[model samples]
Target: MTATAVNTTAVDLEQPLQDVESCLNLLGEALHRRDSAAIELHAASLHLALAQAIEQFTAAARNGTVPASLRTRLMQAGGRVAAQRESLARATAALDRAIDVLMPGEPTGLYGASGKNERKSAFGGSIQA
Candidate 1:
């Protein structure tokens, strides 16, 4: 391949790397702010950007060595993303518990047939023969 072709390939690979870095930065900021909407928005873009970056990086690596600095940044971003995911999962679980407490479902095994202090059905009137 000509020098110009090599230069173009290098530039193409660089674009995706930059995009991935930018997406990671935005995602980190959104997580820090605890802005769910912004996080959702950036998360989608980040997924796509990261995929593209990985694909390009793999291709580039086959032809030449990837820079250590970029690899370091990618690892750091991956760690941050994992932490953020864990935090979100915990928060979601807490919210789910709170909702269940606030609006509980029907009690199970709380009462039995012909048992003293048995709970009555929702319909006020008692069951007739």
Candidate 2:
């Protein structure tokens, strides 16, 4: 039986991570413009794109099509993006908490206690306390 060859070369994950960063920067610009709708709309698409890029990089590395430097870069980029993602998530959570504290009663609000409707919508519980 003939054995199949496996490519062990790593892909450069940095380029895609850089792309992600650029996308994020664009998103920031959109936010700076107070384009809430635009930011919200693009955020998901940007996230998906970054994820796909990472996936492609990893796959290329596994397939041995990626060069050593590219592979290292890909790994590094993945780590960087992971860190950035965590930071963003934490910051977002903090911001939400702050908003919750500040607003305390808006269902459709971003930072607040969340209206009864939101509680119900998310947790299926009434906010009658």
Indicate which candidate wins on TM-score.
1
Q: What stretches of model 1 exceed 4 Å from their correct place?
A: 1-14, 110-129
* Alpha-carbon lDDT, every model: 0.78, 0.61
Question: What's the TM-score of each model vs. the native?
Answer: 0.68, 0.45
Model 2 per-residue lDDT tens digits across residues 55-118:
8776765555555565565466557557646765887899999998998864555344543233
Which window of 10 residues has the lowest lDDT sum in candidate 1?
Answer: 110-119
The count of backbone overlaps in candidate 2 is 9
Clashes of each: 0, 9
Winning model by lDDT: 1
